[model samples]
Target: MNREKTYGIGELARDFDVTTRTIRFYEEAGLLSPAREGQQRVYTDADRVKLKLILRGKRLGFSLSESRDLIEMYDPESGNSRQLNALLSKIQERREQLNEQMREIELMQVELEEAEKRCLDAFDR
Candidate 1:
């Protein structure tokens, strides 16, 4: 018979390249809920997957609440329509925000270049 694997807090922290405190913070944030054995936290494969998803969401610039909502939409028994739609919405919003920031950056760059030209012209006098 084959048995499922479980991990200790340290093992998960190492595998994910995060500190134990980070894991604890996730737990406190209701993102993870590892089982307890005395004082030790025992993590299941589900927990590992959740942690991966959380990191992926963060890397994609998602807020913790957004990550939590996306995670919560997963249900093995149901369709993923809601999750996909929500994700698409978030992506669109992020793209808009990034576009606005890019425009601002371009304007700032133009102003800096003009300022440099003025400074150089003054120096030549």
Candidate 2:
């Protein structure tokens, strides 16, 4: 039988392409709880998955505390549909915000295009 591969903190940091200090910071933020074997921290695949989700949340403009709240929903100890439903609501909220931003960006693009046209017309005159 083959055993699963576990990683140390350094290996996990390299896997995520983040600094060791960053991983430690996440631990400090209560995002991860890796086992401490001696002075070194060991991570499981579960931790890797949580890290991926947390990073994705950040890229999507989620606040750290919001990400933590969402991540906590995945905790095996707390099995509640309330969190899942709340996350769905949050997704809808994010969509609404992005839609509004898109409208603003479109408006800016049109304004910029008009400005460019005016500049070109002046150069031709």
Candidate 3:
């Protein structure tokens, strides 16, 4: 008989380049459920995958709640159409928000440059 592979919290943290506290925070947020082995936390592969998805969602500008919702939408036994559609809608919304922010930043940059030019002209005068 073969035993399934499990990971320690430290091992997962190191592999994922995150602190143990971050993993603990995720657990507190109900994103992960690691089994307690005495004083240690042991994570299964499913937990690892969920952590990976959570991290990916964060990197893509997803809020923790949004990420949780997306994760919960996964139905592996049936299919992933619902999850995929929901994720796509979220991605679109994020892109729209980012685009608006980018526009605002560019406008600010132009205003700053104009102000700097005015300051330089005043100094030259």
Candidate 4:
């Protein structure tokens, strides 16, 4: 007889380098659904994969809702085309947002430089 691999909450937290509270928070948010073995939470390989994706999404600046949507959209039956397309669209949107922020930061830096020059000129007089 073969048994399926399982993980405890603490084991997952250690493996993912996250706090147990974080895992619980994700569970509360409906991101992870681990089976309960009495008082202990038992996570399957699928749960582990979801946790990995959630962390990856967080690193890529995705909001929890966005990550949830993407994760929920996943369908291995259809080759995950829709999920991939949506992810690409989101990536594009994020890139555009970052570009806009960069432009704003550049403008602010120029203004600061001008202000500093004016102050230095006043001091020199």
Candidate 5:
């Protein structure tokens, strides 16, 4: 009999380098649904995969809702084309936002440099 490997909350937390509270928070947010074995939560491989994806999304600046939407869009039946397309769109949007922020930061840095120069010149006088 092939038994699927299960993970305890602590095991997942350790593997993901996240706190147990963070895992619980993801559960509360409906991002992960681990089964309860008496008092212990048992996570399946699917849950682990979801947790990994959630963390990856967070690192990529995706909001929880956006990640949730992307996760929900997964459908292996139709070759997952729709999900791939949606993810690509989201990636493009995030890239555009980051570019705009970079531009704004460059402007702010120039302004700060000018302000510092003026202060230094005033001090020199």
Candidate 6:
């Protein structure tokens, strides 16, 4: 009669492949609201889902504040068209930044290849 999935902070970190400090930071950010089992922090499945979303948002190049706003807007209890529009604008901005970075990376790749070829030619001299 004790099968409720409540993970300790260490277990949660291992399960999520993140640091305990990361979980703590999310807690500090109000993204995770874990309960305390004595001196230990125990995370619920809902907290885990929020962590997953936060990490995914980070991977997608979202700032913490922007990601938080997006998630807050996405909540059924708090969903608003205006907030959705703000999130969409953030997505668009991220896409544009990514496009610019990709262009710079391509240019760097070409330059590196050219430099490598020149070095190889010098070795042949």
Candidate 5: lDDT over CA atoms? 0.96
Model 6, global lDDT: 0.85
Local distance difference test scores for all models: 0.93, 0.86, 0.96, 0.97, 0.96, 0.85
The sequence of per-residue lDDT tens digits that candidate 4 reaches over residues 1-125 is 98889999999999999999999999999999999989999999999999999999999899999999999999999999999999999999999999999999999999999999999999999
RMSD of each: 1.3, 2.7, 1.0, 1.0, 0.7, 3.3
TM-score of each: 0.92, 0.82, 0.95, 0.94, 0.98, 0.73
lDDT of 5 by residue, 1-125 (tens): 99999999999999999999999999999999999989999999999999999999999999999999999988999999998999999999999999999999999999999999999999999
Off by over 4 Å in 6: 1-5, 77-84, 113-125
Off by over 4 Å in 2: 1-5, 75-80
Per-residue accuracy of model 1 over 26-107 as CA lDDT, tens digit each: 9999999999999989999999999999998888899989999999998766678888889999989989999999999999
Clashes of 5: 0
User: Considering only N, C-alpha and C atoms within 3 Å, which residue pairs clash in candidate 1?
Assistant: none
The lDDT leader among the candidates is 4
Model 1 residue 39 CA deviation (Å) reads 0.5
Model 3: CA > 4 A from native: none
How many backbone collisions does model 2 have? 0
State in Å the error of residue 6, model 5. Answer: 0.7
Per-residue lDDT tens digits for candidate 2, residues 1-125, read 98766799888888889999988999999998998879989888888888888888888778779888987776455666767876788788899999999999999999999999999999999
- True lDDT of residue 53, candidate 1: 92
lDDT for 85 (candidate 5): 97
- What ranking emerges by lDDT with the best candidate at the front? 4, 5, 3, 1, 2, 6
lDDT of 6 by residue, 1-125 (tens): 77768778888889889999998998998888899878888888777777888998899888888778776766566557777788679889999999999999999999999999999999999
